[model samples]
Every structure is written in structure tokens, then in C-alpha cells.
Target: MRLAVLKERRPAETRVAATPETVKKYKALGLAVAVEAGAGLKAGVTDAAFAEAGAEVAPDAKAALDGADIVLKVRAPLAAGEGEVDELAMLPRGALLLGQLGTEHAGAFAERGVDAGSMELLPRITRAQSMDILSSQANLAGYRAVVEAAAAFDRGFPMLMTAAGTVPAANVFVMGAGVAGLQAIATARRLGGRVSATDVRPAAKEEIKSLGAAFIGHEDEESRAAQTAGGYAKPMSAAFLAKQAEVVADAIKKFDIVVCTALVQGRKAPTLVSQPMVESMKPGSVIVDLAADAGGNCAMTKPGEMVTTPNGVRVLGYTNWPGRIPAASSALYARNLLTFLTTFWDKEAGAPKLPPEDEIVRGVMLTRGGQVVHPSLQQQAKAA
Candidate 1:
């Protein structure tokens, strides 16, 4: 069996699926590895580095994917009209496709006769911790969000005393206390900022306080059940959201930096910061919206761009926060993919053997046998 790593064709995608470190591991599994030239360049891996790891470096996607039995990528392969090269069409039939392919591409993958495994759908179980790409990537994005916020803010993060005067610490407020939100709180605190965070989940209060950040949210009956069984945030009721917003609005006026990381799995991110709330904020404040790609938590946010309000408030809606720090992101992401593959490796066959009944395999497998087989996607299709 051969595994091919293709260069990401999605615009603004800087991370690659495979790194030289993982390439060598894949080879040890008795599977040949082929990497497209310059595939890992954005993530600081060179063709020579891959070659030194005992992998073949092909000049293009066509040559790399030729006769490949498995394909790894950062994003889904683009269709004929989506990119300069038709990566989807180039893939050999019956090949196993694995990546962060979004839910939108299920039909395409089914039609292509490719068995697709979307790492984003990896179950949040103890055994699958090492293979959870969402956790790994979001952890990086969370740390980067604070760094970007600090850079854009005109004031210092920590309070400093000099002979001239005292510089007060910036007030950082993080919305949501998930993996990304907690990391943002920790990063902000490390930068010497006074941080506070809120989450719909009742359990998040302790997590936020443990990180030395104040917790602020409206808690009630709805809040008690605000988490899904998979440990993801559940969408709150309109009444609950309104009350939560009121509390956040009051706190945000005094906040110098606001990091929005709230996201409901399989749904659009809930709006936490409205335009009126943005206007209430002081001049020269900054907001970093991590949920920009799935619509924004802030009304003023413009995905992939920064907007400055007339009052001098800066709203950053940068998409692909993980891609902003490609080197670190790719390293963690590649390890996640390697971990997943090795966990299900069949030594006798010298290839991966995913049992259909396995929880992890069933959780990530979106399509098989030329059909969208995942139960979640199947239900979604029926509703549509």
C-alpha cells in the first residue's frame, strides 16, 4: 500500500497533513510514502527533508497520487473547477481519503468512489485523544488568538511601573471555555493581562477559575444542560442567550481585549458580541473572533479581514487561526494523523485495517462503498 501527501490547494491553508517526522513513521509501517514537491514547504518542511525520511518526492499531485492506496491532506481535494489542478478527479478509485474534509463535500466524495475519513469527526473518547485533530488544531489556534490580540492592541498586556508612571494591565475577556477558550485564557494570563471568561456550560466556570481568570455568565436551568454528550457546547435557548448577553455586555465595556471562541458543533457559532456591544466598548480596544470561519460571534467581524470602527475599536475576523502559525500547527496535526493510522495498523497485512464496528473508525468514516455512510450525515441528507 502507498500513501500520498498532496499539497493543500485551499486558499489561506498553510498547514500540510504530513511532516518528515511522520513520513518516516508511515514508512516503518511497510507502506510506501509519496509526497508532492513543496507540499510541506509552507509548514517549514522541504522536499529534501522528506526524501531524507525515506519517502519519494514526486513533482506534482498526479505523479504523487499515481497508484496510491491512501491519501492524506490538510483539506479536501478540490474539484475540477475549484482549483488550478483537479485534485479530486486525479485520485484513484478505492483510495482511502483522510483529512479535515468539511461536511459540505460528502456528496462529492461519495460520487468519487473514495472512502473518506474526516478527522474533525473523531470521537471525544479517552482512547481517541491522541487522534483528535479538532482538539490538537484548536489548541494551537487558541494560543495564537491571544498572540494576535496582543500584537494588535496599542497598550501593554501586563501592568508595569516605571519612574515616569504606571502602565495598567489590559483587561482580556474570553467568551467560551472550551479547548480553544481555555488556551486563550492561559495565553492572555501569561502575557500579563487580567483575563475573564464565560461559557454556556456550567462546568466551564471551574476550568476558567482554575486558570486564574474570572468566570462570568448567566446560569439557570438551561445553562445546566448546555453541553452535549460528546462534550461540545450545545446551543442555548433564546432566553438564556439574551440573559448571557446582558451579563457579557456589561463586562465587555470594561474589557480591553475580547477573544470570542464559542462554537456549537455542526452549527453556526452563536452570536455573543453584537454591534451595539461593540459600540459600547471603549476606543482603542481589540476583539479577536476565532469563530470567524463559521460566521462570527461579533456583528462587526469581516472574515479574513480586520475592521476598525469609527470609535477606533479593532475587530479581527481572521479565518484559519491555526494556519496563522503553520509550523507548530502542522507538527501537532501530523502527529495526530500518524497516531490515528498507527492505532489501527494491521501488522500482518502491512496496512491499516479499520474494523467497521470500531467506535473511532465509525466516528470518523463519512463515506464508504460509494455512499455517505455516516449516521450523522445520513440524517442530515434526509432532512435536506
Candidate 2:
């Protein structure tokens, strides 16, 4: 089978789907790889490195996608991206397209009759941890989010003590103690900041404190068990939210930096930080919303833009936090694609033979055999 890794056409996307190290893995599986020239350059993998791993360098985008049995990528093809929708038009019937799907255009891709699979849909089963691209990438976003906030802040993160003066450590508050939020707590703590994190899931309190962060949220026994088996946050009751907000609002006033990372799977992000909440912060504070692409957790955030209020508080809604750390992000995501791609026994019988009952396949298979294969997407198509 031929597998092609094309250079990402999206302007801000810096991650490539295949790295030189993983190219060798594909080679061992008897897969021929045609990597677009310089596809791994931004992620620190040179073309020569890919060549060393037994991949031929394609001259341009067309050659990269042509005659390939599978395509790997970071983002889905949008109508606007060069050679994006173009790939959709040219993909051979029954060919597989796998990558992260932006929530907005997911249905459109299904409508186009492409056999696309969404990487973000990978399940949280024990066997799939190595292939959990969302968690792997979120780990980087959480760490970088704090750094971005510190850079935007006028005050320093750590406490400073010199003969001339004694400076206090900045108070950092993190909303939503999921994978991203917990990492944010660890990052802020490592930077010598006093960190406190909150989440609707009551189970996260211990995880927060284990990272040396104060946990702030309702602790009722019922609320304490709010985590879903998949390790995601369940929406809290209105009464619970009202009480939790009270506990958080006071702490929010004291923090110098606030990181908002709350998200509900497959739904718009619930608003956690209200307009008045932003106004309550001290002057010169910074807020980085990791959930900005999902309509934002902060009421004032605008996706892909930054804003400041008249009171001197800064809110950054930059959407591509993972792109900021492209080299590492690409390496992890490439391994995920490799895991999903190499999950079959070709001994029999079929060129693209797969174990149909595989957890990863069932989780992400959006379309196959030219029919809408994902139940959620199929339901949406009916509603449309």
C-alpha cells in the first residue's frame, strides 16, 4: 500500500502527519511512503532524514496525494485551504482519510462522500492511550498556555527577593482541571507561581493538589462523583454551578493570570467566566482561553483575536496553541497515525484488511464503503 504525507497547506499549521522515525515503521510494514518535499521541515525532520528512512520525496502536492491508498494529516480539508478540498475531490473511491476534524466542517466532509476518520474521536480505552492524540497535544497546550499568559502579563510569574526589594509570587488560577488544566497547574507551579485550579468534576481536586495546586469547587458527595468514565467533565447542575462560581469568584479576584481550558465534548464550550468575572480581575492581568475555538469559556474572548478592557486586563483567544509547539506536537501525532494505520493482518487475504472490531476503527470510522458510517454523523445528515 502507498501512504503519502503531504505538507500541511493550512497557513498556520506547522505539524506534519509523518516523521522520519515513524517513516521507518511504515517501511517495515511493506508500505511505500511518498512524503512531500520538506513536509517534516517545520517539525525539525529534514527531507534527507525521511529519505534515510526509505521514503521518496514527492516534488509537489499533487504527486504526494496521487495513487496513495491512505492519506494522513493534522487538519481536515476546508474549502479555503489550497489543495485541501482539492484532495477530497481527487481521493480514490474507498481510500481512507484520517486526521483531526474541526467541529464546524465535520458534516460537510461526510456530505462529500469521503471515507474520513476523525482523530479527535479516538476512545479512552487502555490500549488506545498511545494513540490518544488529543491528550498528547493538550499536554503541550497546557504548558505553553501558562507561558503565553506570563509573557502577556506586566508582572513577573515567580516571586523575586533581592536586597533592594521583595516581590510576591503571582497568583495563577486555572479553570477546568482536565488534561490541559492539570498541566497548566504543573507548569505554573514550576514557574514559581501560586496556582489554584477548578473543575466541575469533583474527582480532579486531588489531582490538582497532587500537582501542588489548590483545588476550588463544590465538594458535595454527589458533585464529587461527577466525572464520566471517559475522564471528561459532566455539566453541573445550575445550583452547583452557582455555588461553585461563588467559591471561584473570590479566588479569581486575587489571581494575576487565569487559564480557561473548559470544554464539553462535541458541544459548544460552556461559559465559565462571565463578563463581570473579567471586570473583577486586578489591572494588568492576563487570561488565555484554550477553549476559544469552541465559543470560549471566557465571555469576552473572541476566537483568533486578542482584546483588552478599559480596566487594563488582557484576554488572548489565540486558537492554535498546539501549533506554537509544532516540533513535538508533530512527533506525537505521527505515532498516533502509525498506530492506527498498522493495526491490520494482511495475511489473508485483503490488501487493506482490517480487524473490523478494533476499538480505534469503531471510534473514528466516519465513512466507509461510500456510506455514512459514523452514527453521530449519520444522525446529523438525517436532521439536515
Instruction: Write down the TM-score for model 1.
Output: 0.99
For candidate 2, what is the lDDT? 0.82
Name the best candidate (by lDDT).
Answer: 1
What lDDT does each candidate get?
0.93, 0.82
Please state every model's RMSD to the true fold in angstroms: 0.9, 2.3
- Give the per-residue lDDT digits (tens) of candidate 1, residues 159-196: 99999999999999999899999999999999999999
Native-to-model Cα distance after best TM-score fit, residue 4 in candidate 2, in Å: 0.8
RMSD after Cα superposition, model 2: 2.3
lDDT, candidate 1, equals 0.93
Provide TM-scores for the models.
0.99, 0.92
For TM-score, the strongest prediction is 1
* Candidate 1 positional error at 158, Å: 0.8
Off by over 4 Å in 1: none
Give the TM-score (vs. native) of candidate 2. Answer: 0.92
Per-residue C-alpha lDDT of model 2 across residues 285-311, encoded as one tens digit per residue: 999999998899999999988899777
lDDT of 1 at 202: 79
